[model samples]
Target chain A: MMYIIVLAFYLLFTIWSSVKSLKNTESISDFTTGGHRMGLLLGIGTTTATWVSVASVLGVPGYLYSSGVAAIIGWVAGWCLGGALIPLVAYKIRRPETPVRTFPEFIHLRYEPYKQNSPLRMIVGILMTIGYFLLVHIQVVGFGIVFETITGIDYKIAIFAFLIFLLFTSIGGFWSVAATDTLNTVLIVIGVVLGSGAVLAATGGLQNIVDTLSTTTAPTIAGGPPLEQGILLSPLGTFSLSALISIFISNSLGSPASPHWVTRMLAPKNIKVAILQIMGTIGVLLFIMGPLIILGLGAKALLPSLPAGKTTDYIVPLIIQDYAPPLVGAMTLVALCAAAVSTANSMLLTAGTTLYYDVYLGIFSKKVSDKDFNKRLRLIIFVLGFLAVISAIKPPWFLAMGFVYVYGGFGAAFFLAVFLGLYWKRMNAAGAYAGILIGSVGYVVSKAMGASNPFLIAAGISLIGVILAVYTTKKPPIEAYEPYFEEKVSKSTDRVLSSVINRSEGA
Target chain B: MVTALLIWLGTMIFSFVLGTYLCMRIEKSGVKRWGATGKIFKYK
Candidate 1:
């Protein structure tokens, strides 16, 4: 009964949320980016929510419990790359000129400097958007598992609750998700922090946990991973030679190319805030993600007698259900739901907006009157919501925890194309295209063909291909240029988000 | 005890719905002159 009521709370809130987005306008920018007036905080929330996803909470920790610290390092490597490294390598990505409403939007602008056909942009955009939704669908499915497990609710009802609650975000795009994230992030911090403490206490304090694992002697969990990927014994060993080399050159080359992160860069209040997003994101990983790794190890001791190689991804919820007093149990459940909803809402709106604005309005129809565009956008969002629910009913092949494969495939391939290509004039479309193609092919094929560590192989192929293509291409002269990636704007209509970018501010 | 939980839950639902509405209102006002397509309401 309590679970049913909790489900009702989320559903009702989500459904009423989108009533306002019914008549949103019909331009590609309008659909893909909520017309991009996102403030700094909202922008951070959008990037964080989408990046965190259900994979972090459910999949990675359990993998860590069994596989050791290697998995945790593997997951954070991309987040660190995407969040921290992008601002440095892709600093010009934060420049003031372009209406970079999405990653594809950047590709469209940057690639057009060489005047290539839209086919490249379209192919990359469509492939990435599909990959994005696939990631979201896995999360929705995972949430369903949690809901059913806690509430004894039917899977169908659970999915219905998940879809309907998340659908509100689609109506107004980031406005609702951002609003909810303010609340959701606060809830998650409290939940994770307290639950971690309780579980730590429930199992006998932190030192007891330390003694139980004997990881003190076993592995450092702190150091830069070793050549053979062994845990280092000393304090200065965190930056293993392999890790420094791999991270500087080849991080995040195989993950899902998050189209939304780049979109939020243009949405920041100032370039400095764009810099802050890097810090905020890494801070979350260090604080939030770091704690999760510790909690999983704690659970290993608490539930040591249960099983030998079973996925302990279910352990967190099991602990809450069995030990937590009702309110704590309810809040723990809410935190998981909050995380799921934040990601779902962002993905649904992004998919709908991308579908409507980028695919439909840009190519098929032109001059979509504001009224028709908004109506269609709402309709598309509703359809996506239903489709996600339908997709959720069928179990996801990628475990919510196992998204590294897809993230690695898409993130690695796409980030290389966008970041390196945008900054280096020498990087041609052929190089960008080759980077994605080789990386995705290398990673996915390596896995399907039975290779160990498919991720590293995919990234290596992508990096080498892009490097070769760039060097082989003719070098455009190093010269002073425009302050931004200036899109061909219809001077008649001002780009709302682009206008906010103050040129006087760019470094 | 049950009543307190119900009230807390009800308050959250109502506030989120209300808060979302207010935020959307401010957004429309802020983006009004900037050629916001949000105004073109076919659904209305």
Candidate 2:
């Protein structure tokens, strides 16, 4: 009965937030960028919420439970470094003169320079769409797992429920996503922090956890080794140093290149808001990851046995269902669902917007009004969301591996170009194209061949491609690079200041 | 065991502080610069 009430409240809150945001959304810009007037608090809240996806909430903890502190160093430490690096890109990418709604559009404007048509732009756009689609699919899979665990429903039915929920939330665009994401962030913090506290208290505290896990052997799943004593406490417990370093680099460098996160960087009102958003994301991550680590370790100690065929991903849900009070268990379940929905909505929105603006409009449509474009974007959102739900019905793998594939793929393909294109004047269209092509192809070939570090190998090849192409190709003209680097005070700033002052005087 | 716990806690705290400080510095560097207020919202 308590579970039913909590689920009902979740549904009601989602609907209310979507409806309120729908009224505020007017044009494609409003839908895609939230009118570019988001304050620091809302900006930070949404970004953090979006970043803390099902992968972080569920997958990270599970990884910690199974693999020990190595997971923490790879995910938690690496992600903090990644979040901190966002400011370097946020301010420059969100520069007022070349206000781009999507990351692919930025690529076109930056790389193609004088040309109205660039295949490079189209390729990047398509790649971003594909990456985001895979990302949304993972979220849907997570939703199915959580829903099935909590409600005892078939996975297929849970997926349909998830699709319906996200469709309504995404229809209102960035406004709805940001508003609901902020609310979800608050709920997630409460759920994880309280859940951790409950688990710790039940397990008899920190010292007890350390003692219990020290002697306890972790469950063997899918033919993996059992966790021996002292492995969970060591920094590089089971993983090699090279593997840990690779994981850290891939996560830190690849994250900012993600379309959903890039969209968040573009939504804030000003550079200051963007910085605040990054900082807020860091704070939330630290808060969430800290307690989650404790909870995961506690689970490893307390629930050492899993039924046959069950994976570590089942640990958190199992603990909550079996141990916690009905109310707390229901709330935690709701929080996990919220995490999945927030991420899926953002990914779907980014994919839909990229398709509409970059592919449909940039290549096919001659003239599209803002209203019509927004209508098309909404349609694309529904289409993409439905497709994701269908694909998620038969997930490729467990959540962690699925996430790694997409994240690593994106990092290998786009990280070098994004970082160098912004800072290196010598980086030309040839270099950008070559880097993307080589990086993507190398990653695919290496993964197919079962290379141990496909991501790192692909990234190395991409970097070489970038260097060779830059040296061989002709450099872009000064005008092509000016927009990104120039810091001259434009007339627009003067007008904004005058307008603010006039409004104050009139008041 | 105590040392390991202290190391883990210390790393998390350091990350949080360092991240916050870097972001603050980035924001401060942008003050008074053009485009610091970001793009104008033409569409309301």
DockQ top scorer = 2
Q: Cα lDDT for residue A236, model 1?
A: 16
Query: Which 10-residue window of candidate 1 chain A scores lowest in summed lDDT?
Result: A227-236
C-alpha RMSD values across all candidates: 11.4, 5.8
Leading candidate by TM-score: 2
Model 2 misplacement above 4 A: A222-225, A489-507, B1-44
lDDT of 1 by residue, A1-507 (tens): 665566567556555554444344344445555555555566556566666666666665554444444444445544454454444422355453444666655665555433223556666667766766776787787788668767778868988877667767666655566666655665566666666777777878767765655433332222323222222212112344444334323335433245666666555543444544545555554555655665666665565532332244566676667766666667767777877878777777767766765566446535455556666777887887787788878774645334655555666567677666655666666677777788777867877896656657776788888788867875532211123333223432233334222211122
Clashing pairs in 2: none
Candidate 1: which stretches are off by over 4 Å?
A1-31, A113-117, A215-257, A284-287, A305-310, A361-365, A396-401, A463-507, B1-44
Model 2 residue A299 lDDT? 82
Identify the CAPRI category of the predicted complex in candidate 1.
Answer: incorrect
Predicted complex 2: DockQ: 0.18
